[model samples]
Target: MRLHRSLLTAAAVSGLLLVTACGSADPAGDGTSGGLNPPPLKAPTALGSPEGQVNLIAWAGYVEDGSNDPKVDWVSGFEKQTGCQVNAKTAATSDEMVALMKTGAYDAVSASGDASLRLIASGDAAPVNTALVPHYADVFAGLKNQEWNSVKGVAYGIPHGRGANLLMYDTAKVTPAPDSWSAVFDGASAHSGKVTAYDSPIYIADAALYLSATKPELGIKNPYALDKKQFDASVALLKAQNEHVGEYWSDYLKEISAFKSGDSAIGTSWQVIANLAKAEGAKVEAVLPKEGATGWSDTWMVSAKAKHPTCAYKWLDWIVSPKANAQVAEYFGEAPANARSCAETAAKDHCATFHASDEEYWKKVRFWTTPIEQCLDGRTDVRCVPYASWVQAWNEIKG
Candidate 1:
């Protein structure tokens, strides 16, 4: 579903109802232009413990019901452990999520990298009280204290799940699956005008990937960290691909539809497409290009004004539990944040299949973090152009 700006405004004002959310100057956000829009987001708060009822904002698929399988739902277990009634509002994209947070009604939200920092910065999210969440100790240390969720030296949230932007192609249509992102970006005759690209500002990262391989002097560490020269290089590359792309997808379901109908044969995708394609009998596979792919981890963050703080923490502890995390991993098509989730998965290859147990994969896969003026290369001197700039650049490149 395309998110209309009006619906987003409604969601924020309506108590986090099935509302769509949006952002404005916040009478508070950094006044800026270009790049990704600066979220009127609040910064993280190491506030006191959670309060009463647990209200959460998340994408629909993150929490599953027994409809798919009896053991899949993470909330029921949460409900049983703590009497706090769990209230969930599902958002379709990070933009929608950032919009909803303005209402200040939710206790926590599960945000992808693109939206996580916005929430942390907007002060909408309450920092993870690791003391309250014992299971936090089980999370991979590497996933914690990342630059996006941390400021100065404090951590804001816990990493939930992660996956890459790989090229999904049908083995039947293209022999020897395209290794480089070229099959999609280059748009060979067979794939010409039949390819798709992710329809978000962050997607420019893919273009940056091509630059990283084809242009080393630009030194683009994270595609989101585009200097003026590097940023312009990526924009030029994407403009070239616009001629061949059949669709620019914002939602996974929409991308699946385009690919399934054969309107698009080559495109960037997440692992879920491979699983969905196999189930739907579409001859498709996803290949992570050797040039490296951009990926992100979802984070579960609580709000300081939470009505049910204890329940919120209990939910956190439960969701990251080995069983709960694995259930989400199997269904979501990626590795879970909690370490023990790797063991209980029914699929033997589940762990390896999704890079669940691969520490090397974690290092190799450039995890997406919200880009800022400062470089993510662990340096204090250089900084990114900012997200608002990327957003404006995306429009120019797409048009």
Candidate 2:
């Protein structure tokens, strides 16, 4: 059994992550320049320097300072140095992000684990030449070698932010924290009406994770890529979890608001939310089950067809530098992709809180990878399932 959306994430910090203006906000009007297509931006020289004006898409809190006050805005610092203007949009989901990127106007994107591979595969992004980015050498090695964004062994982007999929609960209510997903799937009789999960196509992985734990016979290495038997088992588990969920959320702010307002009590979440709740004096704790957890890592990708390749690359380099990555991590609440960023964080233990620099800890952390037509590990006869299955299953479960 698995709680649906709200209980899964109660998370959007990774939503439309590294959300570069991949598509239009409205999704209605053709974001295209010519009448026929969503405008392919000329890679406007609108921006001037890596430190100056930049157009970026990111999640909430990634760019806020409690004051809509521009002075505190991180991008504002960039704008002051270069004559370039800054245009930023905050997206909450990856699909929304991919659509936005079609415009080709955005300078850079913080692509999530699930979407990064897709962007690279679809030819929407260009390979990152690490030589241009000084801090690239300081990133975690395991991250650099992931299966998703790396194709034929070349990296398509730079590492940015990261987090683990964990169970966040109201410790004030439950006696023993949910050690496994079963608590939520069983609808923990102790906490029924208050359960929540995430609402997104990517969340199918949550079910796959639980199934993998319970049914190892299926040989499912990646949740995003499930065989028919594995897929069926996972869906059955989600269907069972469906009964307990109170909401299927796609917004992080709403999840926090719900927890704060008493609409929710227990659910799955990331380290960021749990810590924030702690800061607010809420009775909450983030639990990493003995069974391990699912997690996400994001990358910085440039548009392959970009009109401003030079400017786009400059921005990517500057942003991934230790200092800039630290600022992004602190503001966003995810682990920094660049290892050196740890020393640059403004908050105490910011790196430690997110477990940014601990290579040993990171070594044990399993990350999400993109699912291709062939089995993830290249199983030939098995006819390994693909990510499309998860997308379909997610729709059915949400429905």
Candidate 3:
């Protein structure tokens, strides 16, 4: 589920950015220079004294100031150590984060794949100077310089955390324990009107990934890179699953409550949500389906026009430091970006539970990314549908 609702104006905002970027031409037919490449926004020269206050836009629970749960706080510790008072605003979805970043009111944001590239393209996010973040070197190597967080070897943001979306079921309700995505796709009708799904366009990748295994002829190498035919097949599968959906969920607490109340018997879920559901006395189990699943690796990005650049850099370093990273990772239910945090987790086996460094396990989980007209799978013969199409298709599927 999306942590927040995407702005209804995402398509409009993205379209405007795309058109404006494409219109600028230094015109010697420089294929090497422009179009779709993120602007080379400069990184900070050096860290300076704390500005005393730093505002952040983040997903729910990412930057906790302790109001939710006193024991779950990391922000207060950072503030106390660095002298930068944290003023955080929780964003429900990537689109909402993008819109908020454009306002230039916040110093930093926790951006997902879908919004990170857009922020970089619109010049709303600056290229990060990794040197400024001392702990960045300790971040998991698998998370660094990937397609979503970096452009041509230039880092854009500091990796926050990563996790796969597993299929969660009420153990008492779903018999035989599902190992494949078919339990929620081709076989969703078995739990008709009791099945749920995440409420975001990015979820379309889950359908595409399922099809990559079930329908090899579709040539769906990368779930995010879909040609017209591949896109149609994925959308069709989602439409079919929609027929059995109890409800589409966005918030963690909502899905946890649904599972606890038995309103939803089977659906897509995060590792944290499943843990929370079980803690609330719900008889539930979660597993990564045999066909694998879609996941996300979030990044903590500084605003291009940050009012407190030095404080923003300090905040970035503070969050990824071992102690703080451990606290946030355990709380958020994701693998810590900092490898050093693994030993610091409250649960002795937390790292093992999430397969934090199991390269083989991660090889099967496709991380979320922003789809563009250019196919991410390196295909050029067929035009791939961009994220805008997925957003529009999601609206239709829900209807």
Candidate 4:
């Protein structure tokens, strides 16, 4: 049975200042970069007594206490097992998560790739000694010590889950199944005023990804790593797309409502959003598209200023444990980080549907990474545009 509704949000915050630097080594060497050198901070060597409570800032549906739906509770079990009461604040966007982490109020955050590096660079997030997290050994090797979650080989957090941004279309509204992002870019006029795109600065990367294939000369190796010309071309494409857009959505629920009501015929979406839409009687389907897609690989990070480090560490270990990981992955509609979670899911085929263990399939999907002046794709001749610029361009694209 489907566990519950899939509720997810995009990550992209505007107006936050990013450190400007260049020519840093790309850690993952997968066309993504964590360029800024982080300040010195160490993980606790050993666990102390539970502090009785842990505060967390997380994306919607990541830290459920069953209050949203009586059957969908994971936080309760964690609280009961560790004697650490769970206090969660759901952030609507990654930008809100970064701002919340800065306050030093929350003990941990379920952060997306776009926000992870920023937290590390500012010293707001602390390194995680993998030895303290026994479950870390069971996590997918592909998710460990990667560009977004690590700095100079030191891990800053635990990988939570991942999913791609997909091209979702109304089966009856659009003609001929689209296998490419062009359906939403070049051919968007066919559905004029019915096309919906994700509303965030990160959406710019979607356009850049399309340009990589359509305009080969742009040399867009990584969507997040774009120099002035590449960045401008991407911005131009989105500005044009805006004319046909019915609405730009950050809230997944709004996108579902739009598709169900036939207000939106095509645009970007997630696997969970498409699943929830179909369940609600919307004739919709989501695809990775021939050009591939931009996505998120979220990490559960501890705050550098955590007041309850011991409990915070316990929460991290508990969340990624097989049972809890499976529940969150199923409910959130993403691949579980724990390799063993596949067998633990309520739906026997949940892991296969989400490609939880398919490493090859993940290669086509580019997980979200923060844009920095230092090119993530390792081009030393020019500086790539930073996220701050993308935030400005997004406003222009929408207006």
Q: Pick the candidate with the highest TM-score.
A: 4
Q: Clashes in model 3: which pairs?
A: 4-92
Among the numbered candidates, top lDDT falls to: 4
Kindly report which residue stretches of model 2 are placed more than 4 angstroms away from their true locations once superposed.
1-55, 61-67, 76-85, 186-190
Off-target runs (Cα >4 Å) in candidate 3 are: 1-16, 19-35
- Tell me how far the alpha carbon of residue 1 in candidate 1 is from the true structure, in angstroms, after superposition: 19
Q: lDDT per residue, candidate 3, 211-275, as tens digits?
A: 99999999888887799999999999999999999988877788989988889999999887887
Please provide, for model 2 over 1-399, each residue's C-alpha lDDT reduced to its tens digit, 9 standing for 90 to 100.
Answer: 001112212233222222112211111111121101112222232333343445666555454433564434555554454444556677665655566676776766767766665566555776667776667888877577465555544567777777887888887677677777767775455577688887765566677777677778877666655667877887887776776778877566677777877777887787878777777777888777655667777777777666555556666666677876787777667888778888887786888877776766654345666444444543445444455555666767867
Candidate 1 matches the true fold with a TM-score of: 0.83
Ranking by lDDT: 4, 3, 1, 2
Residue 82 miss distance in model 1 (angstroms): 1.3
lDDT of each: 0.67, 0.62, 0.82, 0.85
TM, every model = 0.83, 0.80, 0.90, 0.93
**Winner on TM-score (1 vs 4):** 4
User: Candidate 4: deviation at residue 178, Å?
Assistant: 0.6
Error of 3 at 44 (Å): 2.6
Model 1 per-residue lDDT tens digits across residues 219-337: 87666666678878887888888888888876677777777788878888878776776677778888878888888777888775666666667777778888888877777677778
lDDT of 4: 0.85
Supply every candidate's count of residue pairs whose N, Cα or C atoms clash at under 3 angstroms: 35, 26, 1, 0
